[model samples]
Target: MAKITYIEHSGKRHEVEVANGLTVMEGARDNGIPGIEADCGGACACSTCHVYIDPSWVEKLPAKDSMEEDMLDFAWNPDPARSRLTCQIKVTPALDGLVVQLPEKQI
Candidate 1:
């Protein structure tokens, strides 16, 4: 299992054990972590699952796709380099210590 750390806007952090092949949004939703609404259910249609990957681990994840890039434009606090849809970040052994920070607002 990979460990994921979710940091909230208020600076609260929660770590959850995620099974391989699971999406970051799924892990947060399953653990009842606030901030990631995932309104599109991981279909890559909504930006509600937006999260900021910690700079340290950003290089390990796959590059964002066109759809995600379009949706990210609709997200708050969009960081060209760090913004990503949690739904698109799959958990793998290589991403063991993934850390994602939630945006202040998820509209």
Candidate 2:
């Protein structure tokens, strides 16, 4: 399992242990981390699951696919260098201690 940290817009933090191979969206939702709406249920069809990956961990994640990039366009206050769709991020042992910050809003 990977230990992931989800920081809400209000600075609240939720730390969770996500099984390897599970998406970050699932990790947040399963653990009830606020700010990750996951409206499309990990289908990569919505931007509600958006999160800003900590700069230190950004390069460790897989590059965003075209679909994810497109969806991010609709995210609130998108940050090209940091924004990511949690549904597109698969947890792995290498990603232990991942930190993601939620936007002020999802819609």
Candidate 3:
């Protein structure tokens, strides 16, 4: 399992243990971490699952596909350098200590 930390906009933090092969969005949702709506249910079709990867872990993740990039445009206050759809990030042992920060809003 990979341990992921999720920081909310107000600085609240939630640490969750996620099984490999699941997506980051699943980690957040399964753990009931607030702020990730996951309206599309990890389908990568909506931006409600948007999150900002901690800079240190950004390079550890795979590059975003055009679909994710396009969906991110709908995220609230999207950061070109840090914005990512959690549904697009597959959990792995290599991401054991990953951290992601949630935005102020998701709609």
Candidate 4:
């Protein structure tokens, strides 16, 4: 399992261990991390699961696809360099201690 830290808008954080191969969005949703609405589940259709990876971990993640990139544009608080669709990031041993910061809003 990999440890993931989800920081909310209010500064509250939720940490949980998630199995490898699962997407970050699924991990947050499963662990009941507030702030990640994930309206479209893991289908990558909604930007509701958008998150900003800590700058330290940004280079460690896989590059985003065009679809995911496009969807990110619709996110509530977009951060060009760090913003990403959580559903597109698969957990892995290398990402064992991944930490993502939630935006202030998801609409």
Candidate 5:
């Protein structure tokens, strides 16, 4: 399992262990971490799970696909270089220290 951290805009933090093959959104959702609405339930069909990956981990993650990139256009205050949809990120041992920050609100 990978240990991931979700930092809310208010400065609260939730660090959880996520099993391999599960998405980051699932990690947050299962742990009852707030901020990732995941309205579409990991289907990549919504922007509610938008988050900004820590700068150091940005290059470590897989590049966003066309569908995710397009959906990010509707995310709240997205950062061109750091924003990602939690649902699209799969957890693995390689991402053991992954950290993501939640935006103030979802759109």
Candidate 6:
């Protein structure tokens, strides 16, 4: 399991272990962590699951696909450098200490 830390806009933090092969959004949803709405489940069809990856981990993650980039345009205050749809990020051992920051609201 990879340990992921979710930081809410209000500064609230939730740390949980997510098994490999699941998306980051799944970890948040299963743990009942607020912030990620995941309206489209893990389908990557919406921006409700958008989040800002910690700068230190940004280079460590995979590049965003064109579809993910397009969907982020619909997110609330997306940061091009750090924003990513949780559903697009697969959990892996390399992401054990991954940290993501949630936007103030989902649009």
Candidate 5: which pairs clash?
none
The C-alpha local distance difference test score for the whole of candidate 5 amounts to 0.96
Model 2 Cα shift for residue 101 (angstroms): 0.1
Q: After superposition, how far is residue 90 of candidate 6 from its true place, in Å?
A: 0.3
**Tens digits of lDDT, candidate 1, 1-107:** 89999999999999999998889999999999999999999999989999999999889899998999999999987999999999998889998888999999998
Question: Can you write out model 6's per-residue Cα lDDT over 21-53, one digit (the tens) per residue?
Answer: 999999999999998999998788999999999
In candidate 3, what are the lDDT values of residues 1-107, reduced to their tens digit?
A: 99999999999999889999999999999999999999989998889999999999888899999999989989999999899999999999999999999999997
- Candidate 1 worst ten-residue window by lDDT: 89-98
CA RMSD per model (angstroms): 0.6, 0.5, 0.6, 0.7, 0.5, 0.5
lDDT of 4: 0.92
Error of 4 at 29 (Å): 0.7
**Global lDDT of each candidate:** 0.94, 0.95, 0.94, 0.92, 0.96, 0.95
Q: Relative to the unseen true structure, what is the Cα RMSD of model 3?
A: 0.6
Estimate, for each residue in 6-91, the C-alpha lDDT of model 5 and write its tens digit.
Answer: 99999999989999999999999999999999999999999999999999999999999999999999999999999999999999
Per-model TM-score versus the true fold: 0.97, 0.98, 0.98, 0.97, 0.98, 0.98
Question: Which residue segments of model 4 deviate by more than 4 Å?
Answer: none
Top candidate (lDDT):
5
Residue-by-residue lDDT tens digits, candidate 4, 30-87:
9989889999988989899988999999999999999999999899979999999999
Q: What is the lDDT of residue 2 in candidate 1?
A: 96
Worst 10 residues of 5 by lDDT: 8-17
The ten-residue window of minimal lDDT in model 2 covers 28-37
Q: List, in order, the clash count of every candidate structure.
A: 0, 0, 0, 0, 0, 0
What RMSD value applies to candidate 5?
Answer: 0.5
TM-score of 1: 0.97
